[model samples]
Target: MAIEHEQLERSSLTRYVSPKGDFIGFRDEDHYKEKLKEWGLSSGKGAKKEFLFKERNYQRVVTIKGYETYGKSDEFNTLVIEFQDGNLCCIHPAFLKEMQASSFGKESMLQVEEKDFSIEEQASETQEQVEKPEPKLEAKPEPKKPKATKPKKEKEPKIELPADKVHFTASVKQFALTYNPFNEENDEVVVLENVVIVEEPPIELGLAWCSHSKTLKKFELQPGDKLEFDGKVAKKKLAKGKDVEEEFIVDAAVQYKVNNPSKIVKNG
Candidate 1:
């Protein structure tokens, strides 16, 4: 039969088929209907015919792609498997040869339905002799009791931070900066306090000049007019010819509002 690509239920793996009398593919009956619709069949088309054919013969096969059969051998029935990639095939033994080229055909010995048990009927006298006994349950004794005790005092407030505890603090401190040879552009540099070390090279060159000084010296930093200069600690030294090391302490040059000052206690 001609199978149209559009009519084909294209799966990343393989397709499936089963006899009409038996449920196939999925556990839900409605799932079959959904799959049929997905395959462009408003309802099952050739399936009914195929199903009837199998029911009459008492031997029908289910086929699946991308899966394998599981269970016993020496029987005609087999479970179709579709695992990864979703290939599934379930077919009767007769169609195995036809599906060989399709990559989803197989025949195996695994046909057998499990047996079920049946209850036998008994006469009225026999039923009476088989008495219904009363339920038997052992009584449980109560557990011994002791007087309630008071709880101990709460643990002492921890003076040390726990290993897992993260402590945070917001703090503010004053830093000082002073300029030497403030009037000579070539001789002037600012020193910062608490800032471990000031590199010889200034952050910026010719930032701004001191207007009041006769030399109108330029600075690496013109922090602002509000920055107070503490001239007492300002010092200058010569390392190489005409190269000077300027140093000073700045207090409160930078400030921040800290939420936890205790964090700084460790620095002490």
Candidate 2:
């Protein structure tokens, strides 16, 4: 039988029988339909009946490709294989040659009707079971608060040292910048209360010692200036051959290394 190539449904990688070989290539179900339509009946020229050359999966009534079987064998059946380069293949069992020969007229296709054309079913193809899901929960937030503060302390006033508690005050009656006996440095020799009354007689308080005449000169006290000072009193300790060395009374604040600024208590 002669069939036009245009009449063939050219599905890629699907199984069919070609004139080149028996049980040979893969083409989709459409190709199978085309083959069946052509091989089932001859039309037009050379109207001789076409023989049943191959079977898909060696079954009759192969009206459609076995999708279940295809899934199991990675979309291919042993009967045929299709290649990317448009090559077709047949997987005829050499061991089953006698069996195939014995079943000669048993699986022949005179018409497109399904006879022994059942696509083989898988032995363990059971349907799958489905499952249900669970629900979810959310979280909540907390409140805000204020912070506490500390208290402060109070201050006290400072009391300076009283002059009476530290020294004696006297008026400068007369003064001279004289050599200091103790240190051999010049100091202010001043007369305090030029005349003092004791036992109703006038007594010369004579001379008293003061420190740092340069400081006193810078300050300038003429006849009377009330000065406050601390001093070592002249004592009566006899020397080896004399009653005592010549002594004076005032030992000024400067002698004690006091650095307080000089304040003129009065102007004479």
Candidate 3:
């Protein structure tokens, strides 16, 4: 019996760890769609088709099992493919498409050898330096000086967040793009200022980040617009790298992330 798309085994790529120890998975369903569009690849909704996958110096026939989304919010989505040997893996659609070219892995093999040669050269240089002795310099007497003490700055108290959803009031500070490492591009994110919890243990989050999701898009949020909503907040730091600030124009140092905002009310 032929396997159904719904019954296909999950791709192993969702849990794949990169060399840097980070998972190379999509952030959400939207993220996967964006990647597909960027690569000009289809959503893989039609019949399964066989394609050539380059492995080292040879090409192996592989069949597209189907595209699948994992996690509650489709946090990890990718194309699942089954190799000739029955091995299955989740891969980026763009990567799979590129493998269809005849010379996909040819240049990569040479690059790998060059990288290994460079590492060997570095090791030999390190050994030569270790065997060589350092020349000693004569020491001269110097006057001792008293060290100056600097006053320590007070640390800000951490905000306590509620376990359950709470009413929130905030003003849209600005709209900016944030770096999405998975896509190697910027994603639109809304920055909220003067955020406050309306319920007990009322806490204030000076700045918070919320994705420009469909819910917010419906409201057509603008800067300085006051908004009231019920949602949960979590501690998530906004990236503040020099390139991120310059390229994305993200000025605020957001300290929290708003999740699943609903009951949104625009208060002018």
lDDT agreement with native, every candidate: 0.28, 0.34, 0.67
Q: Model 1 scores what on Cα lDDT? A: 0.28
lDDT by residue (1-268, candidate 2, tens digit) is 2332322322332354432435433244434433222222222243222222333333221112111112211222233433333444443322112123446545443322343233222222322233345655656555556557566666643322222212344566554344422223344344454322122332223333433334456667766666654432231111121232234323332111121223434434
Q: What local lDDT score does residue 201 receive in model 3, on the 0 to 100 scale?
A: 62
Cα deviation at 150, candidate 2, in Å, is 86
Tens-digit lDDT string for candidate 3 (1-46): 3543322332222233222222335456655554454344533473
Clashing pairs in 2: 14-26, 14-27, 14-28, 15-26, 15-27, 60-117, 61-117
- Candidate 2, residue 65: Cα displacement in angstroms equals 99
Pick the TM-score winner. Answer: 3
Q: Given candidate 1, what's the lDDT at residue 236?
A: 19
Q: Which has the higher lDDT value, candidate number 1 or candidate number 2?
A: 2
In lDDT terms, how accurate is model 2? Answer: 0.34
Name the lDDT value of residue 240 in candidate 3.
Answer: 46
lDDT accuracy of residue 81 in candidate 2 = 34
Model 1 worst lDDT run, 10 consecutive residues: 255-264
Could you tell me the lDDT of residue 260 within candidate 1? 10
Q: How close is candidate 3 to the true structure, as a TM-score?
A: 0.52
